[model samples]
Target: MMSITFSGWEAVKDRKNLSANEEPKKGHCYMMYHGTHLQNAKTIISRGFQPSKDGLLGPGVYVSRNIEKAKCYPLTVDKKDKVVFKLQVRVGKVKKINCDNHPMQKTWHQNGFDCAWVPPNSSISSIRSGREEDCVWDPSRISIVDVACCVDPATRKELRRLIQHNNRSGGECDLCHEESDCNPHPVQSCWQCGKTICAFQQKHHCKH
Candidate 1:
């Protein structure tokens, strides 16, 4: 069994008590954020080491509804430091997992967390970056909630606040009401115009 963990600002791939850099035998996992973060600080914040292309790397982006696309970053293997990239696309089936009502976990150090791809039920204590499928991105792809659907109260509170701000309340059928503040109808939200509508205004999905 091998172990994988984040320490000193890098995802360290360790095996049998020896660091990947010092180990005699190389483990299967690779160092993902070789230079993405600053290793000098004992106190660090994880922007979630993405390959740098996933489009969410911008500074001060926290609006949940604003994460429109998956950014891409290059993946490098240990053996040769070969430069190749893996496009972490959104899993269409689960891309909209709606963390809207869920509370944010303490595990997340930043607003929009990074994708730490680890296998299901497999401890990072001794793990490897086996394949692209072995890991996954959150919210836009596959959310971290897959391991457990239940979330903490604080995170749920934060998510609810974001959804409301986005006008995606998923609330009452206001279109059917006498006074419709919701032009698009029910359960509709516009990232561009930043408004929510109802079923009657599905067209708003396009027009801001």
Candidate 2:
């Protein structure tokens, strides 16, 4: 129910400097619009909403944002008494999800999480890993473990059951196999080498 309303969309028709009439900027493309739900609603737009064919705004570098439509912005008033509705504010393209960036070093990704290299003087190693000679992030050095990745061993084990549910083992293991000797075992016994393996396994441990 809290909203700021604008009036006189008709008056902006003659205001050539207003954005709705302009073609928008080219580089670092961004656009903003303002208006109201009233009879004489007014709007001001900054750049193209999104790249398009007939509305061909930019073919080069452009801003990227989740809110691509003008109607999605929530209307709110600032402390300075300025009525503003901001939607789809795009700084740039979506390079990665779960990403973090620091000013001084290289950017990398781990377990689908983005990582930014640390500045030379800004990093200190964690006591847990105890490798202070190496440069590391000082912010508790969060290590992301991918629970849904196929490459990481732990994640592959976690996801194996989901992806290969119908495979040889139905994600169960026999306690009998844990012991040295057991005849009838629920664990998967390799058909080739006849070695009992855990039901929940990434692969049958066949060393041959």
Candidate 3:
């Protein structure tokens, strides 16, 4: 298994089991993050992530190795309303698609790769943040570790208390306890006007 740990200050402070440095190896488990609104985070905890029908990489669950990048997600949601999902991803075979229009951008999975990676600061014009991103083709390969709620329960009526996870070593989604399904698309904020744009409709966003 290929395991690489980005033990930024957050990880060291929160997850001690995560080490500082490691090389990427195929089939290794990695700690990644996914950002969403409070409601969506709750739903994801109840269920598991569903692969998107289409995205920048097409038909995968978008995630980031950098928690800072993850925190910027669901771009339209206010920072306080957002929550980041810490995930343990068992990235199988990996493909690097560093530029737009790469021959394998959307077909990496079909070509036997389990994940498509966009390196940080690559020449992808659509990426305003220049942060590392990943698209895992199989939803089952990803598991939620815990949820970091950015919103304060004292301020939000709906968020009475934050989601808590005492054990970080074991990962299990609520899906195992019940039966349910969801088809959720990725969303991002337009760099210019802050409009929430669907990943598929990115080109049409901020057309002023």
**Pick by TM-score: which candidate is best?**
3
Runs with alpha carbons beyond 4 Å of true place in candidate 2: 1-80, 86-93, 97-99, 102-208
Q: What is the C-alpha lDDT of each candidate?
A: 0.25, 0.24, 0.67
1-208, model 1: which lDDT tens digit per residue? 3432211121232223322223112112222211111121111111222322232222211211101111111223232221111111222111111122223222222434442222222333222432111222332331111101112445434433443333333323554332222122234344455455443432333442
Candidate 3 lDDT over residue span 132-170, tens digit each: 889999887877655644667553333222223322223
* Each candidate's clash count: 21, 4, 3
Q: How close is candidate 3 to the true structure, as a TM-score?
A: 0.64
Best by lDDT: 3
The 10 consecutive residues of candidate 2 with the worst lDDT sum are: 55-64
After superposing candidate 3, which stretches have Cα over 4 Å from the reference?
1-23, 153-208
Instruction: State the displacement of the C-alpha of residue 109, model 1, in Å, after optimal TM-score superposition.
Output: 26
Q: For model 3, what is the alpha-carbon lDDT of residue 51? A: 78
Write the residue-wise lDDT of candidate 2 on 45-130 in tens digits: 21212221211111211111111222221235222222122222222211221112332223222222222211122223321221
TM-score of each: 0.18, 0.14, 0.64
- In model 2, pairs of residues that clash are 8-40, 9-40, 9-41, 31-47
